[model samples]
Target chain A: MAKQFNQLAYTNLDDFVYGSCPNPVTTKSGMVIGGGMVYPEINFTLPGMDINDVTMPKAATIYSNIIEGVLKRAAELYAPGVLIEFETLPDFTEHPKYGIEVNRILLNGMKEASEKYGLKTAIRTTPNDLREFSRPPVMRSGKYWETMLELYEQCARDGSDFFSIESTGGKEIHDSALVKADIRLAIFALGILGCNDMEFLWKHLVDLSNANSCFAAGDSACGFANTAMVLAEKGFIPHVFAAVIRVAAVPRALVAFEQGAVGPSKDCAYEGPYLKAITGSPISMEGKTAAGAHLSPIGNIAAAVADTWSNESIQQVKLLSEMAPVVAMEQLIYDCRLMNAATLNGQQLMFRDLLVQSDSALDVQAYVLRPDVVMRISAELVKTQDNFLRTKLAAQLTVAELKKAIVEGKVKSDKRDMKWLDKMEKAIETIPDDPNEFYNEMKSVLDMDKFIPSEYGL
Target chain B: MATLNDVSQCVLDGDLDGIKVLVQALIDDGTDPIVIINDGLIAGMNIVAPLFKSGEMFVPEVMESADTMNEGMKLVKPLITDEDIPSKGKIIIGTVNGDLHDIGKNLLVMMMESRGYTVIDLGVDVKEEAFSAAVKEHKPNIVGMSSLLTTTMMKIESTIKQLVADGLRNQVKIIIGGAPVTQEFADDVGADGYSDDASTAVELCDRMMSDQSSSEALSA
Candidate 1:
């Protein structure tokens, strides 16, 4: 309820500590046994080779071993009066049922490690392989969210207090945006579990421009975190936006005033730089971009905002194509092993120093017609970007243009496109935009007439 | 007195309930079930397929339309005798082992079925042995495989190998599809062909079937 947020007077980033990441480590031996995306970094540092070179079955073994090492490390870090949290990359559990069993075995070990070692400890949730399917009239959550929540719920029942929502799927424009809604909705649903201590460690949402990189799960986690924080900051429902170009010699500066959270599947890796730069209050300022299993898109997003009201979790939406049980499942190992072995400091710092141009400094009129300006610029940029789905700026900017067309009587006022667009843009228009309402509006657009029921067959 | 055009309209409108009411009326009028299926329902699906390829219809809408066709088929099926049901073809489809995504695979099944083909959906995470066993059991005209992830996509090749190892590869034509699949990928995997989407998938199956029959006829 909007009433829930009116209760909060204010919340700020000063309430937290600056988290630190690790530098690239050296291999103790010539043989790189493990400690990369596919292995637990207990004895071995990252090797020069690709993590995917290790078979998945072998990687699964390494992942299980990593869980064992986290317990060992936690025991050493634990003290009676102190609480410690660490990142675990026990990615890609074999079969869902067997994976659950493995999780229980590890959780029992974790609880034992906590009690025996005399420390309060928690590990972030690991995502299972995702499979979205269509079953006519609904897009069912096949193995992806169903298995994730099952594992999450099992952890909760078994005394795992710290939980995060992790989900991954659909790398298209409408698809990823739909995935965002699914993640937000899942996070909203999982919030009821009373797991207030949430963290962002996910299978990345957007695709990277790097020819070498696979999907970066952490990038998704970070964007989710930013959206969560942004949701927390505004403290209200209605959200609005104006698409604008604030570009300079380096492209990073172009995004300053907007503070946008871009979600695209490929080549739009800008979300990573935009995400890594944000500093916010979380359970811990620290995070681990480990080489996780390239399966589920981790959905749960959490930040320790300066102030968090109970039961106030982000609520987004779900429902992709008209078919409920027939979602497409496509996978990429997305081994970010080389980068995962290294630190995020380079990514954060890389975007920090770029030359920036500004449009935020313009007059109030510029702000009022910002969406119009977005269209003009995106239209120009479209010529440069052959990969349209990879970038949401033009599509969203066009949505902004579509709205202007309706208002000026150039398009039908009662059109489904206009109605859904109006709802989303209006939600985006709200100063403290409602992530729930905004996400739902975008989702509704996918459920329109032309997309489904038409006088023509098929 | 309902013509086939009326049946096509029901499919286009994605009106599941309407399909039953109209099909029932035709049956009441003593219309032959085979004619209803061939000229009515199948004709409607043929039109829908093109619209779908043109992006005029999406997955959800197409699925809805497909659902309507299935609904109409229920009434027509029982009425049409085995003599009237000379099978166009039979297909066995499944997503490979460790690869559970099946939207594309399922879509192809629906498209093929509408064209008077029988389909056996083996479902997601199907193992190689399962494919061989199913091919033996069903003796399908085509064995369709799908994998959404690169990690599991290799299973497509392995499954192809298993089919050959089982010696069932000669019995059935193999077609594969998914997000990462391509014509080159299809060629490398030694597949009969690749389909970029569900529409072309049916076309791929039809062409393969025609070729198979043509070769058999030539040999005879």
Candidate 2:
């Protein structure tokens, strides 16, 4: 069961299918190895050099250091490949052409790391981070797309092992059919350039592709969830994730088992799955360390599947033991009792560290049950992004509804609090009982609202 | 007949060709250029603003309608005399220095223009000195700074300081906004106003200008 992928000389889909096996087997000579994108931090330049001043060749050391840190852990966990994305900090003003320099620096580092560790490397393009890097994506324009393809062609020539082509249709082209078409056209171009060993962002494309593409959709609580069964018919590569809402995780576990996609490449333990389900960060972070929370049951369920597939205990008793306290703390955070206690500083990271790393529920309860600790934790997470997004969305809804309620004479003058509750209850009545429909329609509305400034008359 | 409704619809639909044809027919029909602009083209754009703010309309479509407004403006501009032109106020706006995000500023500029204000758009990634220089030169009634990064948003304070240092702070109303900006941040930074979105920014501006006029009358 040793996986063999032609570096970048893929001709057909069967080559990819051979690599993306449906089941994991424990054989020293052959394993259906899992891989993922790594954001292991490194300067990518001389150790102390400014990020803007980073130049290639000398930068290979930084890449090697970063890739080495990420891969060593990945390998320790039995995962084989790692995806590298070019994150241009500051801006892409220098070598802004298709992020060529940035990718070269990463590729050089990957080549060094692969040789050093005997691991596979893939450049994930779906969550390109180009926007953060200060450049538009290929899908931004035909010319940009053509130019990006040429740059990738150069990367293939310059020794990129594999490419993960995920087309995230931006504001202008977000129709599902258009997203698929964009991915198809991109794959066609990459194929023409003789690129191989691919990961299509969506599993359905992998199911339909002639290029043995495996699914690399990030663990967006629902990545490839809609069609995991369809992909399981071909091979299960859909991400299995925990959801923020508890009830949603059950069907997810079933799909993961049905699809045989026990890959860490598409799993998020807590905030990752929750955020991805609501927002569209399919391949968010793979680890739960940063999120500082547990995935209710999906995390264990996913671990159990891995345990069964690999025939290893994959002990999470310690991880699970830490959860009860965090669960209680999360309830406190969710209810927002912490915000009224004090203004939090540094996002109260001390709480995340203490609560997430507790050896047992007893330790967490003893540590967190104190008033001082609760205040510290609450204020910090309130100011933090995870809470901010959820709170902001709720606030926006209430404000919009309040205006409507006032207009409709539903709320009488001066009884604001009661009127707000009345409006909120009325608003809840409008949403159907179906969770799936609510999530889908909410996602659509949010996507439209979030479209870039130009759409709003900019 | 080229009713204001037709003009409004053409602009809302982003029919540039139709606007050119219809606006010219209105010119021949002896329609007031001010009415053609205020009740027709601008009426279409005003509809676009709230729809866009509410997320019912998209940017590309809004740009089309804005472009129609511009086209109709070209047709109607010469017809209105200097005295016929009603000045709302002057505004200087830009995405603050080191920030490339300006979608909000662009929409605000379009909305301000339709409201009959002269806007000097400094464009994206404008440096603090550049903002100060624009203020010094343009002498606008309001200075609007935009940013999408918390890191770059610090530059908003610096830009404000630069304005004060340049002795231009008292000459203008300062308003700040972006994804990360809050009304609390506005007060913290000593800005006169802060709005979360573009449409609200226009209303803020109008209200601020009215306040300014009331103050001036009292001072007088």
Highest lDDT model number:
2
- Give the least accurate 10-residue stretch of model 1 chain A, judged by summed lDDT: A324-333
Candidate 1 interface RMSD to the true structure: 11.3
Q: How far is each candidate from the true structure, as Cα RMSD in Å? A: 16.2, 17.2
Q: What fraction of the reference interface contacts is present in each model, in order?
A: 0.00, 0.00
Standalone chain B TM-score for every prediction:
0.92, 0.89
- TM for every model, in the order presented, reads 0.48, 0.44
| Quality of model 2 by C-alpha lDDT | 0.44
lDDT of 2 by residue, A193-302 (tens): 11111121223222322133333223222222212211111111101100011112212221221222223223332222222222212222322221222222121112
The prediction achieving the highest DockQ against the true structure is: 1
Candidate 2 falls in which docking quality class?
A: incorrect
DockQ of every candidate = 0.07, 0.06
